[model samples]
Target: MKKIYCLIYILFTLPLLSQEKEGITHSGQLTGNPPFPIENYSELDNPKSTSETLWNKKNRTFVSWANTDVRYNKEIPAPIALSQETLHLSAWKGEQLNAQLIISAHRKSLELNFEISDLSSSQSKIESKNITGGFVRYVMTDELNKDGKGACGPRNHKEFDSTLVADPIDHLNDRLSIAKNTTRPVWVTINVPRDITKGKYTGEIKIRDGDRILKKLGLEIEVLDRVLPKSENWKFHLDLWQNPYAAARYYRTDLWSDEHFAAMKQDLQHYVNAGGKSITASIMNRPWNGQTYDPFQSMVTWRKTIDNKWSFDFTVFDKWVEFMMDLGVKKQINCYSMVPWRLAFEYFDEASNSMKTIETKPGEKAYSEMWGAMLKAFATHLKKKGWFGKTYISMDERPMDVMLETIKLIKSADKNFKISFAGSFHKELLERIDDYCLALGENYPQEILGKRQNRGKISTFYTSCAHPRPNSFTFSPPAETAWYGWYAAATGLDGYLRWAYASWPLEPLLDSRFSTWAAGDTYLVYPGGRTSIRFQKLLEGIQAYEKIKLLRREFIESGEKEDLKKLDTLLNGFASSEIIEKDVAQSIKKANIQLNSF
Candidate 1:
């Protein structure tokens, strides 16, 4: 009997042991804390002060890191020397403060553990709740072969080419690994709540390997009493085109799937949270000439009868409108092309009970008739949905004559329709166009800029493959992005626009190279739910613009003419520089100090 009882006991407990070992003993319950704790520390020191084992100089495992006000040429690997020792950052209450610690490893792999202690002193303590740690994988530049070929692709532009192979571990919330002497930039964001006590808070960042601590870096954040308002009062209007269809394709989901919708919501929320105000809505088949992988899913579909009469379906349109409104994107709903490039489309024929396709060149009677009906229906729908006032009938980069014809067709449908275009510098079309998105290098006539500024129209400039300087990319310096806002303020432009925000390349997370455009031209943020260092830097620039605007407002309101003049001088001088990242932060800091004193 004892032997039989022993066998049964063993049988019953073995399954439980296996389950525990597999990390599923209890369904839906997590195992424990991660391998290392993420917390703030009070000290910064290198664990291997004298010994060089932490980074092997000969094997190229040596590391170098620093905290900079702006990032420039960050894709290049750093030298094997310790660069900087501490992180000093500043922000106003209700602002997200950003700092980056760029780590370069040469020729060896490393596993690092990180933690931060609560920032505190005898007077006050800011808990870990107000702090969060995350990182983005940085791709390094590779040596191009004699043929100008590399892992990413052929080196089109010398400055924008990258040789780093994409790795999953480079993104945030994953194990970090440096391939044989490469550099990776890890971003740290501290969101200071509005109610937090305004003062200087200090802490340390602990990096280790198992129990052996690698480095402890000091952190100091000075939170000012002045609060940056969360309201959408920004003078700059930015529209980074949101592509949901590409997102679904990249993630391998149906366009209407819950997963796709959830992913889109998260991305849009991030965009709006970073001071983005405008939303891109596709009225027809696709935008940008189907330059993307999948068709730009139209919110509204059309049906045609035997008599050539057209009707519409609004199921998808309604859902998208409700979804965007919930995400606080009511500022501007930009509807793409009454006349898209190539003027091609497919619609259902109700009388024949089959689908029909139509491809017509510009000025074709068929094109005009079809687009006229579509625009009329769209205008009526927008009015019914209460979005007409905020909607723009958008056409992108078309010939001036073609744009005029398109506008004429739109007016035939609804004379009161507001039109928006991103095309060449056409002096004749300025009065007719409601929103003009011109190239950054294009000369904007003062009268045009003045009229748009006075009428609150969106007179913004965009950049793609045409211009290289002041672009938002991994290879470009962080200051390039910040200059967009500063330049806008100095030039008296109302806003800025980029063609694509989430236009994913074949292997976007690992490589951003496209066949036609520059490597980073296709997109700003990465797929698989990751944010890029470039995106963060862009936010920094936008916030910097906001800060300057606030200072100017206060100075003007207080009747401090001298201070206001000083602020103007500072902005104008910074705008004049080809490289503005290095000095913009310091200038803004000095200006803020002077404003605070008053």
Candidate 2:
């Protein structure tokens, strides 16, 4: 009976299997992207030689953005076109597939023919004679074509090449397969081995489909050099969240001019000199008055008048950027604005012909235009000087759609774009954050936000291990924030971020008087020669805690699975133990205070 049943099942399913395969027809072709060259020079335009310039000067990443209405303003050459193509690597490990390429050509029917070559273990490299392990798998979509369904939104599709690949090799051992195209922007991808060496790796991907060769685009992949093993003890990422009330506000001319600038620089230099690595400066012109600068406002108003062509004046901001650079401060500029609050008008009294106003209704158009101009100017300056990855652009507390658009514009202008944002653990911001970091995974979020994204974008909490305000008068500082930080890190937060490490110094800069961060009357030492005994102890504890966190990152990043597991077990074992329970609990409390203080 069993044999008979088996035969009957196979007999019936055999017809279904044949039908399924018959229906699984190739609907489209997987074509390589066309070449679109944006002349990327190395370092800068050398003053020494006009013709002696090397074709490939330095290692660089491609730039990308979302604007189709490109009007050639010969007055200024368009910024070096970002990435010649959008490189996608959505494929996983040990997959039979090699890569995925999407072109902006929209044509009906016809299957895509892909040419897969195994650069790893193949002979006669140029010829497609030896097809190895990998094969192409793709489904064509008008989505990323010359229509709105692509990276930017609807009606925004312009011709461009976008390539996605799954290479198993490391940075040094990358292989490329190109697609050919003439009219549309072509996409190309280079797959590198996981164990790529730490050095400059250069290669080229040529796009072609059948007889026609599309274009040739250069590719540069740089594997970051490993950091000092000892320095890995401390996590050095911190956020600057000081608003007007806390920040010492003086006239821009007074504070930013020579005298004040020098003083400020000296102070920061002292801080870095003492022991500071990174500081994110929240950019706000004035202090926040709850009514006017209230970040709690739901709707952000913007002037509808200014379209894509609008521009804003950012003279003062230029100086700000310069000052930050001069101070040797690694800063993240926040393009955050309150729409309705920025608008000067509130209610109008028709009887007296008087209109109530707020602080300034800095329209969104003006903000957007100003930011774009600033980025273009800054990016161009950096590119010319070649500080591509040194600066970052950040947006805090803005709508997702608007922020995404802003990111597109900034990225379109410069491929090496970085941004960050402040997020709330509240339910609203937590849901669907992956969409925001849709392109870059959570590891390297250009738009730094408070929330976390898994496999999508990188994020860190604002203050999960420290309090904005510490009880200076009392010697005891909260230990709860530390626990919270640990919890967040455990849940996959990239890092822990705190705002305003030291706002007000208590005894002539000995200790912070107002905040709970104070540890007795002692002041932590600053580069500017300010220190308090209590704050010093507090800083010591923080430094130690952060060191533990950093060790966790290094362990995980080391790619030693067993070591990671061991460390995890050790950390978890001590998590609830009395040995460090108070420290962890106090850290959590401090973190909560800081979050709620806002």
Residue range 333-422, candidate 2, lDDT tens digits: 443332221333232334444543334323355545554555575676556654445445654445556555656666766666766555
**Highest lDDT, which number?**
1
Candidates' C-alpha lDDT: 0.63, 0.32
CA RMSD (A), model 1:
13.0
Name the 10 consecutive residues with the lowest summed lDDT in model 1.
Answer: 1-10
Q: Candidate 2: which stretches are off by over 4 Å?
A: 1-235, 241-253, 265-284, 287-328, 331-388, 399-416, 425-457, 464-492, 502-528, 532-566, 573-598
TM-score of structure candidate 1: 0.81
Candidate 1, 539-577: lDDT as tens digits: 766776777788888888999999888878766655542
TM-score of 2: 0.38
